[model samples]
Target: MAGIAIDGISMVYTLPGGGEVHALNDVSIDVDQGEIVSILGPSGCGKTTLLNIIAGFLSPTAGEVRMGGTRVEGPGAERGMVFQQGALFEWLTVARNVAFGPRMAGSPVAEATEKVERLLTTVGLQGFGDKPVYQLSGGMQQRVALARCLANDPDVILMDEPLGALDALTREKMQNLVLKLWKDTGKTILLITHSVEEALFLGERLIVMAPRPGRIEREFRLPFPEQALSQPAREVKAGPDFVATREEVLSMIWNMEEEIMGQAEADQG
Candidate 1:
């Protein structure tokens, strides 16, 4: 009855040419309740695909994903997702977008409105509620997206590089925002990111995925959530253990380049 379980799963996709693309190979990961774990990997390693499987957006070729002792066959509100692109509805106002979930789940408008109001402020988007999603700044739009995902109060949150599209400065601010939200919510979180620094800063446990036919290559345990934000990220980023962990993760990913290239060739051949 842990938060979520990825049990010995592998996924294969068939291309139009009748060729098989192996996305995952016997990948197994256990995310404990209220813990935040990050998945890092080289490009084309299917890290995102694994995340999708966990979210029930795709069925695994083999094995299963379970949450709260129940099998995950399709999307459910118990698991909320913050996609990389925000994925907000273009036509809805900010408040409407956040209220969308609860309303659909049979919440009365009065209750949904009240919940939306609280969530907008939680993500620092209080006054932006009535603004058209397109009218808000990039950071604010993302805040709305985050609040929207949280409105239903899911037990687990899955993020696929949610801040990856932001400018460097905005990305840092959003990282802190996400950390604060995680602390407040204490939801089990699975984040997939390409940035090593990001993975280190946000994850309580970090799992590095190997090149194509992605498998767990390395894991690191950190006492990060206990670290005070009184110290700047740059200061923590320079710690001996932090540097070593980053290098270890980076080395594993860099070494996978050849393997990914080979897999691509094999598929092409």
Candidate 2:
């Protein structure tokens, strides 16, 4: 079990013409072990940028990331990333895709096979392992993605809208799976989503961000996720607390988005 500490992280992008765009500004957050956190914000709010930084795929221009009390200089097996798309290899079977990490790490064949089978079963794809990646539906592909990440037994799972491309029904089902995985595996999770409902449903702590020099704007520690554990997702979502929190977050994001649009118009004018 490990916690992630992101201290004073910021990102600055230099455009081709010598203009500087600040993508993140002094963003800091802590995710404790076995806890789930979700980041919710409008497009261009640096949510993905933040996730990438934590994944060590991008180096923040300033500050550092630490996990389990050690500095994170680059990508490692302890940190797994799930992108919007499954990003699975079309040529590989589902089982091979899930086993790739363990196999590459030099685990013996039997051990890797057992790990793959367990992960497939965990992700609700026990029999689908023999199926090619191209044969699965969007939801199933995302399940494979989650299973592949788990195969590495990463201490922290970073998800970037892993369910964004799915239909409404599928997305709801995936949300339940994520919550179940979190409770069962006790792995720290940081999910980036555009849905307020998803954020509230999956995150014990929710962060809302603002763009144009993206930074954390608001955060809520809510009980909706824990509530969802005992109740059906739909029922939990319909609860008063969920509805109230959803409205509050939506209103804040909408106001921030309006401010962004107004600033853009003024700059053009």
Candidate 3:
């Protein structure tokens, strides 16, 4: 029942030209136990950078990240990550790729088989396990990646635009699939995406981050556990509150993008 605590994470990177780039400043967010939190922002808004910090791939310049009670200094099995390109090994079959995590952890093949099969079913890839990773479409490959991450049985899942490359229809399908898996497995998930509609639909809690030194801009608690998945998405989206939140986030990003662009313009002027 452990969830991640991101306490005032701040990061600054020095460019080769000697200028400092402030990526995130005091970006504090928390995903409660079994909560699905979605973060949305424009490009260069440090959304992926924030995910990297949570995965322990990049250390914050200041502040701390903790799970349960222990601090995170580096990557661990408890934090599983999925990337934008699916990042699957082309040489491995779907089943083998899914088994990689458990095998590395020293779990016997027989014991791991059940988990693999269940995850494949969860992602709608149940019968494609024996296929080569290259044979699948982009959307299907991401599904395999989702299945692979679930096979590890990690405490928290961090995803960086995992469905961003798919076609519009496929992306919608994957969005629903993500909701299904989160509800079924009760995994603590922190997903970073640029789609405001997605953040509103898939997340039980919505976290909005501002750019030019990413920090918490806003947060909203969902009204119900199954509000997003209980009915037709089109119908649910027609509700006034969903539309209002969507517009609010859109305005936030619009302003942030303008500010970033204006800064660049002023420098040129």
Superposed Cα deviation of residue 161, candidate 2 (Å): 0.6
Off by over 4 Å in 2: none
Candidate 2 lDDT, tens digit per residue, 56-147? 98999999999988999899999998988948888999999998888889999999899888888998998888999999999999999999
Q: What's the true lDDT of residue 124 in model 2?
A: 92
For lDDT, the strongest prediction is 2
Error of 1 at 239 (Å): 2.1
Comparing 1 with 2 on TM-score, the higher-scoring candidate is 2
Clashes (candidate 2)? 0
lDDT of 3 by residue, 144-211 (tens): 88888888888999999988888989998888888888888899999988888888887888888887
* Model 3 segments more than 4 A misplaced: none
The sequence of per-residue lDDT tens digits that candidate 1 reaches over residues 106-177 is 989999999999998889877888889998888888898899999988889999999888999999889888
lDDT of 1 at 171: 94
- Supply the TM-score for candidate 3: 0.95
- Candidate 1 vs. true structure, TM-score: 0.93
